[model samples]
Target chain A: MEEQLIECDVLCVGGGIAGLMAAIRASELGANVVVAEKGNPHYSGCGRRGNDHFETWIPEVHGADKEKFIDELLKTAKGEILIGRDILRAQFGKAHEIVELWDEWGIPMRQKGKWEFAGHAFPGRMMTHIKYEGRFQKTVLVQQARKRGARIMDRIMVDELLRDGDRVIGAVGVHTREDTVFVFQAKAVILGTGKCSRLYQGLTPGMMFNDGHGGVQTGDGRAMAYRAGAELMNVEMPQRHIGPKYFAKFGQATWVGVLRDAEGKPVGPFVSEPDRRYGDIVMEVNKLAPEQYGERGRGPVYMDCTGISDKDAAYMRHWHIHEGNVSLVDHMDAEGIDPRKHPIEFSTYPLRGGGLIVANEKAETSLPGLYAAGDEAMGDISAAATFGWISGDTAVAYARTVEHGDVEVTRPIIAALESRIDELRGRGNGPDWEEANIALQQVMTDYAGKVRNEARLLQGLAHLRRLRQKVDTELMARNQHELGRCLEVHNLFDVGELTFHAALDRRESRGLHNRPDYPFKNPLLSQAHIVRMEGDRPVTDWRSY
Target chain B: MPPIINPDLCIKCDRCVNICTEDVFFGSKKHETPVITYPRECVHFNGCVDVCPVPGAIWLRYPMPSMIVYRTSSDYRAPPG
Candidate 1:
């Protein structure tokens, strides 16, 4: 029953790429920042492992004009970006400075005195990506934050936000390993807990919860924001991703270069094939994979690297050292699966969808004193960095204006959170976190998957409601780690239900949500469905950019 | 499948135990190698391998699913290595 109280000006939760960047920025701006992460900050969250490509604006390399970039984005970027223009503009303006700061921090993405860009130059670069060895990006960012005097409290998972009236003041969490409770009272809170977990068991008749994206990203931030009455955007867009079937970790950009079918036949005319957007391997694979790829009857797919010259192979190998999941190379080597000698196998993994917090250019959620970053802000890495930076600036400024004490607001919230933990610890036998997690994933994939219908969505919605009951009353955790997972599963279920409701609300098929029931886009429902909590239930408000 | 620790080379430094964010291995004892209790829980990020000071002290064994390049025998267009 150890209780710990941390007071800071800015509290950055999640500690992934965006959270770390936010911490560094906030701390640099003279805020006493504290980062509360569920896992080790260096190797946690979606961006923990590493990334090889950073999507940015390298104008010199790929003629950068704001209008043309936004125009091309509507043309090529993934999914329907109805309200992401301002976010894109924010990222575009800050790309050069962010890269420069990153370079100064040691991982010089740009080559000396030049912007060496790679990937996606069709029509003109869509400000999509540039190849870099950013394996140590998270670690370096963590170091920078510490150097600027930000205290990183790893292994604490923030479960709920502390609010006063409509504004969020702080958060409450528990230790993932020990019996410790953390009460973080901050002037401004940055909910950079990344996006939802890789929850949807992709294209399978049964549930396969193997597709986890880095350290458990189960939409804790978005869920917390929702419960706190913060408006959430894009809750229904099921974030589909095609990845290596078995080794299903998240960021595998540029890893699988050229994919060939099971018959040694190349999946030609790939968008990557023409543009060399090596990062689009997944999208290309998805476009080319046979109709029923992951099903038992379907043929296997492979990444064929046999045609690559010896010189290029060595060069590729060298580049991987700087990227995250460098461990994959070790895994491949240990398995004796050579990309050159043996065609590397791959398949798909799917998350139910992104339930992103509705954030402005400054990363402010609808709720005051609360901000969202990372994919929770729903932009690429450059946007993540940019949003993280700007949110820090805005949050620190907001924090400076607030009074120091909020004990009256935090006291009752802390008592409730403690009792909740005690209840979980006291429980003996009930469904474990895995059972509940798998059940929710099944529900999501079965009803609210890629293709959906009104009847199916309603059925899924009812099942989710029942499942939420089970998760609330019966879900038990043995120790701190299990408790952490239980908290994550709870958040995932909440986010899943939000997505289901959003799916049910949106009658027509648009973007990632496909409703064969209503074949075409409904002009009436063209705007983004912004979901917010109204007196305990989520209500959707249609908002146009 | 799971990481096989070479006891001979393992000085029991506890780097793997401390670094694994997944909680894959049980917490370590002083001078005792950590137990890989939750082997099935290994998501296979290989933070342990990356942080291991001793070379080849820890290595991963990918499960059979990764090796299954061909889902069925009839589809023999590209055979497994």
Candidate 2:
């Protein structure tokens, strides 16, 4: 196959909110930019479906005291992780401005004269969020980026970053449909591939059929960065939460409704309250669920929406439909269940790989000319937006200082990547990729998932290592779809191993990294677990917050 | 489930087929009218309806009770005091 090469001043990989923002900022700064997207920019990443609210510290609404706001934000991190204070300050400082930009783009930020906002209640006093009908957020961002003159290459999955010495020059990807290889040469590269969500069973058992994070997020950015010798943090701290069991779509309904026992008695405060983080709420419920729903007890835990007025329920349903889960209501109706009558059943699931690609306030990785943003760069959407904005300007500034280098230096790197793909294609058959993937998911879900102990983690790590060897040599793809799945499994192996090692390294129980053996948060061990590749092995280090 | 396409109203422009990430719509040829080949894959982000040039060419049959909810594209404004 022939190789296709494209040159630009900035190459933004993974065209989610962060990548699009980077491309838009770079283009606005008069830099030639190209966006390589695994899926269409119009509908990719978590932002594609839309979000209910935007979290920003609007001084006018909250306060002008920036120091106080940062302190409050740090409190939410809860000593378990070292959130870059500089990044948090940068995010809060620009919060209102970004919100204004969204509003100027004709995206609604308020339903009425008042902005309905609520904190998860880790610190309830800070109501720095505003509800919005953001179903068209991706469309709006794509339009803005295009208007700023950033060319978008859709369905191009970037598999590796091209480096000359220590600096990243560009990236190499494959066109899933055209069967062509794409080589993007640029002065700067931005990775905004979102988080790794399918590392465990997603939402429900069979519902794992599609990655809960829009079927595209696979820790591709983390995997690529690790291979390039970049540092990643908090690989073990998984985002676990409670949701409607089989019908995870109705999980968000918990935010608006009240939690109840099987007998329909109110059990606890609604999730919208500002007293505790949602994760803590899930932990509380998980303890009570088995006892309350056991055969000896009433039945099953549920989100009781019975009290929600018809008008409010209508509004909620409209919002849910646009979030790409309209099937939730349909499934309910098919089963003769009604939110107005029956309470939705609940279960717990892990959301994504923990604290990811470590970068500075400017979103620049340890490696020069390379930037990380979105879930790969930060933990939340608000921080992702801030990182995206900052990284775009940073990349543009860096581009101005450097000139485009020769593409010949990348030939060896391109050849190596292509050979790997060729080897996969040459393999006739062995263990099925899907079967191996299920085994991988089963190992993580059984051991490293919600529950964790030294013994279980070690056992999971051994199983994952065996699975990784099988995947590297035996996995095969006959078509474009299978090829995409094969690549995803390859990336998942990298993430799974890192997650297990990180889990084993952390000796104390922190916010999300709950180890029954440790059972307590140790002040001495309050540091971020940093992981990086040493040849083929991942080495762990700690950095104090 | 995928957004239901009204064959009568559809101009067969193939806008929905091109925009959907799930490849929900499939046909023998590019110009041929496409059918919803994989409804289960549709997350229903509703980008297809927004891009469709023809009005009423596609509509989602939401579950009952939710059927009463009205879908509109207008921005939320403050109600008259």
Candidate 3:
């Protein structure tokens, strides 16, 4: 056995698109950087299976005017999360700069005039490379970081940050395969570990098995940041999108493009019509075609691509050939029809996008030298591609500002981390991280889901509230690997409170934060509901975008 | 064109919705399954089948010789005369 000592100026915790961008930015600024990803950099993270298309808040993509996009986002924000006009506008304006950053890293963006794509009202302003595998984007970004002298440590489960006083100086993580623990020292520590969508019960069916299995997200950044006295935001309200209703169905990505009427019938001109927000039509579809929709059998309309051309089948075949997403392909085969020759059926289920975490423009936390990125960082950019890029860029910029100055780190903080690590190691070697993690998912799924009322939300909040406390006191990890999972669940318990609280504060329905009790979008609640753990009691405030 | 499908290999994940530069596929509604509405928009790039987590779920049939000849640009150009 050999000990490897690696040092850097900036340490990135996750290697998704956001982490990669941050690493690139820091490296360019002449900083020695190290990125530790919990999973394989190539096969894991949202960047692995998603389109390379970038969604910008620019008017070219939204419409001839920028106000509509801003308004649409404010509408989506729906009273929770920060919607500051300047902040939102600034995030949008940086889209090109972020794209240029990607371009500098050798990830070529397709430049097509009058571009047309799926899932947008206007032509795509996104620079997309369509003819290649989705992972190609990640592969290229990782390669760029490697070229820039950024060290990448893959499959290392980061358990906690190594703190000195209130400042985050480094991280302590373990290699999952070899079970080797390493303390990574740096001038700045950035949290880019995506989100915990998998923790929200049955909503994450296919995603339940991947390493953290939706368990890793639970706001690891948020929990750690809060413990360090950083301000958290919108902890009460988590966002859910329309998802698949079947067992472990993972193909919700393709169906997001389908548009239909209340009767589950094809809308307008089928293939040629421009894409628009069909969410409003969900209620109508439920009314007209309940039998076809799902268990509730509301307006279960789907896309009718029975007239697919041969060329189109070849295009879709590439995904099945490469990624092996057989849900659609197998259904087509069973029906004895081809997607190129016949239309495939489509529908929606409820999918939570995880709540947003708040941070300043520099990706700085209330606690200094601690930064947040990816799904855990907030402002108006949690789930979108543009926001992820911006977060990464912002975090890297702040990391550059960090200097190993004459300022001394307090001894108390270092002692605290060491004591906590020792205490965690001393606990009973019994709790299965996977089982507890799955239990957390079931709890969130059953109670705090798409149709949240006071009863279910309260019940979920109460149980998760208590569950978090018990896990902290009773649960113990036998090794560093299990400890990583334990920390993830603990973070989930903290962030889950944010989701529940936000849902309770805003007594109205808007965008993804839908409420069956308060079914209509309430204009009175249009003001953003800002919640932060101000001195124990979850304090709530209001602001406008 | 022959149809293609491979089922035992399908997990039905939604990577296709996240990709598809052309917005060719739409997600399913509550009761019904998802559908691919715009086959014409497909550029035959193979991103969908290639990105599927399961290998054999997507089936591919070759373009027939006659059908290929009919849709070719050369065949359409001469007919304008």
Candidate 4:
């Protein structure tokens, strides 16, 4: 297998929403952009399933409440969502511009030329989650990027970033279906590879391919950035989201109905309004509410939409574009169970790996030539898109001032990465990706799951260290696809260890990082964990964001 | 239950094989229909059904646990929005 060296001005490691936005903006700015996508650009990343709404602050709906919008993000998401004011401001400031761009790119954001508002209450509403049919967001973004002359290389699973001294020159990737390795050499690198949830999921034989929001989110981009001498923040906490059973799905219709206990009592808010952070309803339900339920009842909660109008029921059914397993609608329809008539069972699972790592308004990472956007860096779809938009300009400007790294500097980095890939190939029998992945998941779940203490976390770290040794020496991949899985599992190990350490360092419980030893949120430790490698060793330090 | 590919209706277009969002099926060179090699991996997004020219060629049968048939009262309308 020959190594292909592709040179570009800016290399985007993912082709998800952020990557496409970065590429679209960079290419539009006349920078030669190359997006290395692990899956088909038309159907990869988080927005691959499409979303019902993009969480942008719309002025028409909220009366342009900037402080209210920023406050809602920092507070309403269950806890203090340590997001930078700059990132939130960047997203809010350019909200209309991005919406217009999305509308122009054929994503129908407006219905009869008006954004349909949901979730937020009317009078003094702070947030406006605009509704749109986001099923083809990727396809539309891909079409736009291609039209702008940005090359989107599909099935290229980017394994690692290529560092030239302190700056990220480019990245190393493998063809998911072929033996070829793509070594991209660019003046600047922008990572938009979304969040990491599959580490907790990949081993589930039933869920071999899906995450709650994205397809194949293994924290690969985060791992790549960390390994390339970059700092990762807010990753100490992974999130738990509430949704339907069986499928890993979220949003869309899940939040529409009222939650009921077994006794036909309203367990959760009606979500008619003031229902920002609806998970708070579930948590409240899980407690001893004797006055509400007449007894201590917790177990299973059902979402009852029987009271909503036919219009709203139809709206929910219409919103079922399978970002929330759209096929469930067919199942419901076949079973003669209209959700407006039938109460759907709902449960909460570890939804998001919490932490809005640092990528300021300019979309710059700690490293000079690298930018992090979307889930890989910080913020939601809007922030990811906004930073991705900013990354285009920042990455382009940075790319213009520098030349590609000299061949001598890149030669060894490529060689080291190639040797590791070679070692993963053609091994007949050893710990396959599933085996290693399951082992890692077991350790993570046992030690670092909802409840965490020092002893268990320390033990988990030791177990991960042993597992890394086992995977490093005895891991096997039968094919290129298996090879990609193997690499993703390796990334899971890195990220899992990073999270375990981050969890260990943060002494108090806050949001998703629940340290049972120190149960309550500590004002002193109300800071974000920044994880970075200190020359062949990973280190985490609490920093004020 | 995962997505079952019905051989009787499959036209061997390879549409499901190439266009599956989750890559649940392997392209079957030996026959017209594709193989559900990664059946457990199927999240049942139904991209295969959307792409399949033939009706009933591809369909997702979710597990019984996933398909809870709890029917609420048809007349249970009290909480006004």
Q: Highest TM-score, which number?
A: 1
Q: Give the Å error, residue A173, model 1.
A: 0.5
Model 4 residue A211 lDDT score: 43
Which pairs of residues clash in candidate 2, taking residues 3 or more apart in a chain or in different chains? Answer: A121-A274
* Model 1 per-residue lDDT at A153: 89
Docking tier of model 2: it is: incorrect
What ranking of all candidate models by TM-score puts the best one first? 1, 4, 2, 3
Model 1, residue A182: what's the lDDT?
86
lDDT of 1 by residue, A3-112 (tens): 88889999999888788888999999999999998878888776676766676666665575765766666766455565667777877788767987998897768656
Cα displacement (Å) at residue B79, model 2: 50
TM-score of chain B of 2: 0.67
Candidate achieving the largest lDDT: 1
| lDDT tens readout by residue for model 4, A1-545 | 78898999999988888999999999999999999988777766667667766677777666656778777656545346576577678878886689889998898888779887654332243445677778778779989999999998977888888887887888888987778989888899898888786666432333545446644678888887787878888677776655554444434343456666655676645343223223124432332222224334554566666666777666666677724346667777777877665666655544345354467788888888999898777746777777888899899999989988864577777787678788889577898987898788778887888678999999989999999999999999887777888888988898888888888888888766778898888898766678889979878877776
After superposing candidate 1 on the true structure, give the runs of residues whose Cα lies further than 4 Å from its correct spot.
Answer: A62-64, A120-128, A202-209, A255-257, A262-301, B68-81
Could you tell me the lDDT of residue A36 within candidate 1?
A: 93
lDDT of 2 by residue, A108-129 (tens): 6666745656424333356555
Model 4: share of real contacts kept: 0.38
Worst 10 residues of 2 chain A by lDDT: A272-281
Q: Model 3, A387-502: lDDT tens per residue? A: 54554455556566665522224344444544555566688664555566666777776776667888888998888867776676677766554555566666766666767777
Instruction: Please give, for every candidate in the order listed, the TM-score of chain B alone compared with the true chain B.
Output: 0.77, 0.67, 0.54, 0.73
